[model samples]
Target: MGGPVERPVPEDSAPEQSAADVAPVTVGQGSVDSPSGVERHGMFGVAGSGDTSGFGGLVREPWTAPGAQRPYGSYFDEIVDGLYEAYADAAAAITKVVVERNELTLHIAREHLIGVATALRNDPSLRFELCSSVSGVDYLGSTHRLHSVAHLTSMTYRRRVRLEVSVSVDDPHLPSLTGLYPGTDWQERETYDMFGIIYDGHPSLTRILMPDDWDGHPQRKDYPLGGVPIQYKGATIPPPDERRAYK
Candidate 1:
């Protein structure tokens, strides 16, 4: 791989983020023999087989075909179907299914999260053994905003997929996956810290960074960058009227 991956700061045309509100990124040390595979944690990993059938350069599987009646049925077909079957009520919380970059995402409600996770993990076919990553995205002004996405990997087939779930600000109570994937502890805390999402069963939910007294979630678009009336060295500092303009 290249040099240590640096945390990416958005350009002037990108969404406005505070100097302090940088996205979290961890760089890995590794090398690649071929461009077709990606190295995870310094190990070369191959992409799944079914991921090849798509239009143009697009890789991920499409949700539905022209005449297919029973949803999508392929390598992930049984796994997804079994999940929805086992937890029909819990899975019903899922509002949408999106396929992008060879990943199957489940947009679910917060309340049914734990049940849905448990069902996914326990089911034989969809043995989503590891909860690879859990991160939150702030869709600020977008229609269905304030979303949290969880990426799960399966060791059995050496495949990877994504599951996305969302909740509004008023009720951001997602059932914690810490019990199922113990690693969720830190990710959940980070999500709570930056996005103010509530993980109901998180063993210990606290701010990973920033002072506990901080007023608002920095990741939120509506949250102001800094408080007014800057005072430095016991003197009122002059304010600049320079506002961010995008092209």
Candidate 2:
């Protein structure tokens, strides 16, 4: 069995200390079905009415994803080193390196995405042969609100790594990985369709799930919840936005 890998401590950072001295970083928050904040009674243009649901008193606090500490054991060290050696020129493009839950995640800048992907695949030491999935996330309160995530697997080493790139919602374009991994075509499109993230070099980035005539990305946090009326069993129901929900 391989011994635990020791990570290189940054010279500029503080001296290495016990794990107890390090504060844990928050990663993700509430799930899509149950987000953190409660929708106000009248905030969505409904008439002013007191909420009767017991959840009305609920309040949510914002939490940011924090970077993880090093000594990221197992094969994480080898993978990071291989990537650094393979793409020396793009070294500066890396923003953060996180190893958590026995997984390695590389936070890369948008401009260097293609180069990084190429190196991750072609580099002999880091033969990440498969680009497993492409997905997107909307960090509602983050400065760079949109995040594109790619999962890569190295069959030879039986290892997996995640590449993440963030972009502001205003300028939501990132270079496409279709050139490297053809399977990402539909996945990227779906992510774009749902999150409004544009893959710059995508051959045809039309909506995969939503209709072409859809007005807006439905998955965005700020998107209107409900306005259209629903009819079932000859009964009319207000749109989700207009309905009385937890405040």
Candidate 3:
């Protein structure tokens, strides 16, 4: 009933592209077990058969055995709460003191890092004996932003906990815990090298791996994946997408 459609391109111009040039696609979640399983997603236009298990095999969850028994309310608990409360009262910028899954997590304003770390390390009852590890996680596309996770273990109380501190990419600065826990020296350096988190009080903040002239932090989520373009000497070298580097 309608009039015939007319082509707009001139004879010498490029051919008119069809809908196939930009086909609509369905996108499924990354997990194979999800109910909304089979769907195509992303710009590459790859389709999904909804199969995540390799070669039709089932995916097995890792085994976690039960742990040994430990005493309740170790001496740390007696004044731990009170000591933290005191520090929170003295420091206005300390944001939160949370105990979740038998672990203590502290959140503080970046500017108050020095005072808070000092309080936690020096507080007699809540004396966090050791700084086990310092690590940073880049959440480039995540809603919560970048989070720097610090793990601290108390040798005297034999308890372990994680302290999560966050800062925006625009202004990522926190006091170095090296002064409070000397063990943080190497760990902080690693975090700095990987995530570009600045430890304001760190003694030596330098690139531990890549050359100092490198432009960006390699471990950040937004960092580009880079590798040399390979030219095979004799045998065919499959492109990066087809080859399994690990194998």
> Using TM-score as the measure, which candidate wins?
2
The backbone clash count of each candidate, in order, is 1, 0, 2
For each candidate, what is the lDDT? 0.57, 0.71, 0.54
Winner of 2 and 3 under lDDT = 2
Residue 242 lDDT (model 1): 23
* Residue pairs that clash (backbone atoms under 3 angstroms), model 2: none
- Alpha-carbon TM-score of each model against the true structure: 0.61, 0.72, 0.58
23-78, model 1: which lDDT tens digit per residue?
A: 11111111100011111221112234342334224333212212223454445566
Better of 1 and 2 by TM-score: 2
Best by lDDT: 2
- Ranked by TM-score from best down, the candidates are 2, 1, 3
Model 2 residue runs over 4 Å out of place are 1-59, 227-247
Please give the distance, in angstroms, between residue 72's alpha carbon in candidate 3 and its true position after superposition. 14
Predictions: Cα RMSD each: 19.1, 11.0, 23.3
After best superposition, candidate 1 residue 213: deviation in angstroms? 2.2
